[model samples]
Target: MEILDLGLDILTWAAILIGCFFVIITGYGLLRFPDLYSRIHAGGMADTLASFLILGGLALQSGLTLVTVKLIFIIAFLFITSPTATYALAQATFVAGLKPRVDEGQLDDTPPTDKVEGGKD
Candidate 1:
């Protein structure tokens, strides 16, 4: 076996480090944020981004044809599914009428009128 190519090894390590950093930041966001809805945003966004980064790093490190193909599938799945899931969760929050933290009141606890003009028909 030849000495590990320094450049390739460095690249591999960098990718892995970046992926791990995304996960760490996600965890930190989840811990530091206030409110359940806000925390959900943090978690949803973090998991999506971290999943992409990790799949990408793993793809980079995969050195074989079949492994590369499988890695590509993983990347594809993550790209397609993660954001969709996040969007669904956010939509659920909206449909459930959870007031945004900035609103500073539980306004949504009362149903919003569907009227378009100053809540008038």
Candidate 2:
């Protein structure tokens, strides 16, 4: 029993550490990504995966109990809401006329930038 318990603890810790790593990577993505769309994509995907890993770790640590139930509920909520929220934000940005940056090799489909006739040279 003791050995099993120790092994479970080790697995839980590993999951938590991996989750934290993903979160740190997400932060880096936010800083390094060149545009809003890319940043959102990176952050959203990492965040969803990280949440699953971290919550799974917590659920394992909790064992069979009310805490575990609550953790599962939280994970369910996150799973449903995160992607929906990201999609809504991206949609809103599109409706608001925000354009994503295009690389030289990529075909540009975004509307042309509006020129301000009186803007400073």
Candidate 3:
């Protein structure tokens, strides 16, 4: 029983750590990415994954409890809503004539260059 509990604790901590790492990366991406579309993509995807991982870790640590149930419900809600929200935002922006910046000249066989349009090299 003790060994089982120890394993569970380790798993819980690992999940939480990974989740936190994703959150950091998301923040960096939100800052580093150019254009609203890119920022939205990074924030939407990474935020959802991080929330799931963190909440799942908490649910595992809590075991069969009300907290776990609540966390599960929250995760479910996020799973349904995050992508939908992202799509809606993108659609609205597109309808409002906010086009994503695409370098059409670079669409061919040439490799990407180190020079970013609005970022440091």
Q: What are the lDDT scores of the predictions, listed in order?
A: 0.67, 0.82, 0.81
- Give the RMSD in angstroms, all C-alphas superposed, for model 2: 6.2
Q: Tens-digit lDDT track for model 3 on 1-121? A: 9999999999999999999999999998877776777789789856588999999999998889899999999999989988888888888777666567685543343332333343222
Candidate that beats the other on TM-score, 1 or 3, i.e. the better one: 3
Q: Model 1: per-residue lDDT, tens digit, 68-99?
A: 78877877777788778777877776666565
Model 3 residue pairs with clashes: none
Clashes of 2: 0
Q: Order of candidates by lDDT, top first?
A: 2, 3, 1
lDDT per residue for candidate 2 within 10-83, as digits (tens), equals 99999999999999999987877666788898879565889999999999988999999999899899889888
lDDT for model 1, please: 0.67
Runs of candidate 3 exceeding 4 Å displacement = 104-121
TM-scores, all candidates, are 0.69, 0.82, 0.81
Off by over 4 Å in 2: 104-121
